[model samples]
Target: MDLLEDYRRATFFFESGDPLGAARLLEPIVEAEPHNTAVRLLLARAYFNSAQLNGAEAQLRVLVEHDPSDHYAHHVLGRTLERAGRFREALPHLRLASAMKTQTDYQEALRRVETWLGKNSAA
Candidate 1:
């Protein structure tokens, strides 16, 4: 199938709650287009939703390194790290995302991580 068809099918799989299927469809596309941020982001999200935290973190880290000003990348990376029990590593990215975008979701995530850090640190 063409790239567009693959992308459509991947999106359909993702929307239908089959993240593993989506990731399967997206993996080759990502390999073929390493610089395609949109495809990479979608693959990262698929990995994340499928509980592939390491894959998601790897893709997100690459995205952040390629474009540190990408607020969404930072936000997603932070969330992925937090989900992986790496709250300390997630904080700076979350804080940067919040500062860059001022999104409520980002702020909420930052707050949640901060609280977790505080609780853990006090222990």
Candidate 2:
């Protein structure tokens, strides 16, 4: 199969919510496309869903380093930090996520982020 087909099939596994299957299929592709930011991000997210936070964090740290302005990466990292009760670390990412938010005007994600940050700071 063509590379696109392979990627599509792997994506199908990923979208089907089988993170391990997706990870298994995508790991090799990663070597061939080391600079594929999207792929890296997806793999990181799949790791996150699989409860492999360290693996997810590793991927995300690379992505974040590559593009410090990517709010989605920051958002995912923020959520993971919150889950771990690392609120201090979560604040910056959450703030970045808020700044990057532009869709769903009613969401007020920035406010939420700020609220969390404020709450943590207060404690």
Candidate 3:
């Protein structure tokens, strides 16, 4: 199968709530296609699910820089930033995520960002 197909399968596993399976499936593909944005982004999501926050953030940084208006990228990037204690950096991405869609997850993430921002501002 092609790398893109492999990546798509990995995403299917991830969406089905098997992130470890997705990560396991994506590990080799990432080595083979390091510059593949979709693979990198999917790998980042798997990493986040597996608690590999640093790895997730690294991949997302590349992804967001390559395409700034990738709302999902910014959403994941916001989650990664918040986990890293970079609350300020997470705010804009979270806000963008919220503005880009009306999903419950995005709204929840945005709410978390706002709470963090409030605390930060008060400090």
Candidate 4:
């Protein structure tokens, strides 16, 4: 199989809003080129978009481990955890991502997680 062609098609599928299709195409590419950060990130994004939270968390964890300073990876991991109702676990990652960068979304996620934890803790 042509990896480049597959990557392009996967990207197309992702951009076309068929995240499951993108994920299906990306799985093999990620397996073939595990070190390709871009491919892995895209694959993680596809998983997240497709509501495959576990898949997204796995890929994002690898990305974070490979590069601790990857703000986006941390942010996505936190988001995945939050979506899966693991708010407490998502806190540190969201905080780290917010600290690493001043992106609005990152800060917003951090705040949302904190709120969830607060409300739940008060229960």
Candidate 5:
């Protein structure tokens, strides 16, 4: 299949709640188009949804490193770290995401991480 077809299929799989299928399809696309941020983002989401925290983190880190102002990347990275039980590490990314975009999800994540950090610091 062509790249576009693969991308469409991967997206369909992801949206249909088959993240592993999406990830499997996306892996080759990512290898072929390393700098394709859109594909990378989708692949990252696939990894995130499939509970592949390490892979998600790696992809998100690359996205954030390439574009610090990418609110979605920051938000996903923060969520990935949070899922890994790294609240303190997730805090800055979550805050940055909220600062870059006024999304309710980002704000909620930032608030939750902040509360966790605050409680931990107080202890």
Candidate 6:
């Protein structure tokens, strides 16, 4: 299989909103090139977009471990956890991502998670 072609197709699938198809195309690429951060990131995003939170979390965890300085990975991991109702576990990751990057989206996610945690804890 042409990995590059597959990657491009996966990217197209993802951009076209067929994340499950993108993920299916990415899985083999990821296994063949485990060290390719870009492929893994795309795969994780596909999983996240497809509502496969567990897969997204797993991929994001590996990314964070591979490169702790990857703020995007941290942010996504936090989001996956938040979506899965693990706010407490997600907080640190969200905070770390926000601290690492000054993106508005990051801060917004952090705020959202914090608010969720607050409201839930008060219950």
Between which residue pairs do clashes occur in model 6? none
lDDT comparison, 1 vs 3, better candidate: 1
Q: Cα lDDT for residue 112, model 3? A: 85
> What is the total number of backbone clashes in candidate 4?
0
| Model 5, residue 103: C-alpha shift (Å) | 1.2
TM-score of each: 0.96, 0.78, 0.77, 0.97, 0.96, 0.96
lDDT of 5 at 105: 94
What C-alpha lDDT values do all the predictions have?
0.95, 0.75, 0.86, 0.96, 0.95, 0.96
What lDDT is obtained when candidate 5 is compared to the true structure? 0.95
Task: Summarize candidate 6's per-residue lDDT along 41-115 as a digit string, tens digits.
Answer: 999999999999999999999999999999999999999999998889999999999999999989998999899
Give every collision pair in model 1: none
Q: Which candidate is the best by TM-score?
A: 4
Tens digits of per-residue lDDT, candidate 1, 46-105, equal 999999999999999999999999999999999999999999999999999999998899
The candidate, 2 or 5, that scores higher on TM-score is 5
Model 6 weakest 10-residue run by lDDT: 114-123
lDDT of 2 by residue, 1-123 (tens): 265666777788889988878776666777778789888887887788888888778888888899998988888887676666666776677777777775442134445655776876776
- lDDT of model 3, residue 86: 82
Cα displacement (angstroms), candidate 4, residue 56, comes to 0.6
Off by over 4 Å in 3: 1-21, 120-123
* Pairs with backbone N, CA or C atoms under 3 Å apart (clashes), candidate 2: none
Model 4 TM-score is 0.97
RMSD of every prediction: 1.0, 3.0, 2.7, 0.9, 1.1, 1.0
Give lDDT tens digits, candidate 4, residues 30-65: 999999999999999999999999999999999999
